[model samples]
Target: MKATHQPPTHAPVTTADLLRMAALYLRQHGWTQGTYYATTTPTNYPTPPACAAGAIGIACAGHTVEHFTQLDPDTLADYLATLAAFVDHLDTAYPMFLIDDDGFALDEHTSPYSWNDDPARTAEQVITALEAAADESDQLHLTGGQN
Candidate 1:
């Protein structure tokens, strides 16, 4: 008799989940904390706020780092969405220096694969991948000047 093969299972990646994952990534990279709000701007804020208020925001060491509105559909439907773009921006700006899920450091000289085709991947998976890369980056930073 032959055994049956089964595919892995993953929960749907909700907007809240994405937000939490992003916050975790930010914290891992030295961001202090994050806040979530229902409106883009707080009603009681004075003019010229230090940071633009949004549905979600994160700060690092008392400095505002990021602020953005919520994702539509409450789920990550495509890589072209704002949240994904934000992640890309963070990766580029801060150099999370992530290795691939397979434990291979992504070649800085090469382009990464477009995630548009695999929108079904869960937020947890994405965070895990990023965290692994960040860990590697931290190790490299601690051991040598390379990053």
Candidate 2:
């Protein structure tokens, strides 16, 4: 007798729902590759100059499953809006002058910094890039490995 493996079934869902499911799946499966953490402070860099004293901000990160899934347009828009709002709030509330993958606040840029000028716009741009990547991933999945 031969064993049969079944592929996971994922129904059409919202981006938020998919994100939640991915998070849950990663946690349940103990998949460390998809998991990540960001620090509000400059932990990756050296102290003092690189990291200002008492500079604090929010650390946000998430993981996506290996499976490719289409994102509901409305949900994706909502998620992007929420992210923009959060970034705007953080920019207004904190003295965050620097931002990186590690969420570190390193040396402050000189005047006329692009990100400092408009954090919300920057956040939106970031979300847009991510959305494009997601779309590509979905396409690749649909095509069965062709990127």
What is the number of residue pairs that collide in model 1? 2
lDDT per residue as tens, model 1, 1-147: 336766558854433343444446443432211222223455543221221111123321122323222333332242224244444444654344447999987754222223211345343444454454444434444433354
Provide backbone clash counts, one per model.
Answer: 2, 0
For model 2, residues 17-117, the per-residue Cα lDDT tens digits are 33333333323332211112223334453221100001110111122211112334654454444344334433544434755779886654322123333
Model 1 ranges off by over 4 Å: 1-117, 143-147
What lDDT does model 1 reach?
Answer: 0.35
**TM-score on alpha carbons, each prediction:** 0.27, 0.24
RMSD of 2: 15.7
| lDDT of residue 82 for candidate 1 | 28
Instruction: List ranges where model 2 is wrong by over 4 Å.
Output: 1-70, 99-147
